[model samples]
Target: MAIPGYDSGNVAEFALERAGARAEVVAGVVPDEFGLERSGRDPTATALADAVEFVGLEELRAVDAFRIELVYDPSALPPGASPTDVGIAVETDDGWERLESTVDLEATTVSATLGGRPSGSTIVAIYDGTGES
Candidate 1:
C-alpha cells in the first residue's frame, strides 16, 4: 500500500507478507519541532530529511513480517552526508531504534523489514554521521 506524504510529495510504501493480515495505514511528515527534538537524541547522528510517521501500526503486531519503505529528498541532507550514510530508524518503547535497511540512492528510498511491530510510534528517520545508534 502507498501512503501519501501529504504536502511533502513523498510516498511511504508498506507491504505485509502474512496471508491474512490487514491494517489501515496513515502516514505524514513529522512536524519540524518533533523531528528536530527526537532526531538528535543520538549524539553522533543528525536527521537528513523530514521524519515520517506511520499511523495505525499497532494492528501490524500480529503479522509475521512486514516491510516499510520511505522516500527522502537527497537535497535535504546536510553537507558531507552521502546516500550511503542513510539508514532507517523506528521509534520504540525503549527509544528510537535504528534498523538495518537497504538504500537506493537513485530512487531516494530506504527500506527495512520488521519481524513484528514496534512498541511505540512508527517513524521513518534518516540519520547521518558516525556509528549506528
Candidate 2:
C-alpha cells in the first residue's frame, strides 16, 4: 500500500467540493489520504491548511493510492471556534459554497494573530504562479 501524509482534510472531500459532486469527510490527517476545501464558511481557515495534489495515476503503473497534506492558519476561525474541530469551505464561480455533508478535515494549526483577532492565510490565494506557486 502506498503511504501519504497531511495536516488537514482528506482528498475525497476536497474534490467533491471542487467538482460539485458528492463526498464524505472525516477528521484528522490519515497517513494515506488526500485533501480538499468545500469553499464554505464566512471566515474559515481552510485556505492556509488546505493543499491540493494530482499525480497522473498512470505514472504509478496504474496504482490507486495517493496522499494529501494540509496546514491551515488558525486565525481564520471565528472568535470562539474550536481549533481541534476545523471546518472546510469551497469557493465556486458563483460564490462561497459548502461541500456536501460528507466533507471533513484532517489536521490543524493555530498561531496568535499580530494585534488582531484571527485571519485566514494568504499563502495559497496570493501564490505567484511559479507553476509551483
Strongest candidate by TM-score = 1
lDDT tens digits by residue: candidate 2, 5-29: 4223332333333422222223333
Compared with the true structure, all predictions reach lDDT values of 0.50, 0.30
Q: Which ten residues in a row have the lowest lDDT in candidate 1?
A: 17-26
Clashing pairs in 1: none
Give candidate 1 misplaced runs (Cα > 4 Å). Answer: 1-45, 131-133
Each prediction's TM-score versus the true structure? 0.57, 0.28
Instruction: Tell me, by lDDT, which candidate is best.
Output: 1
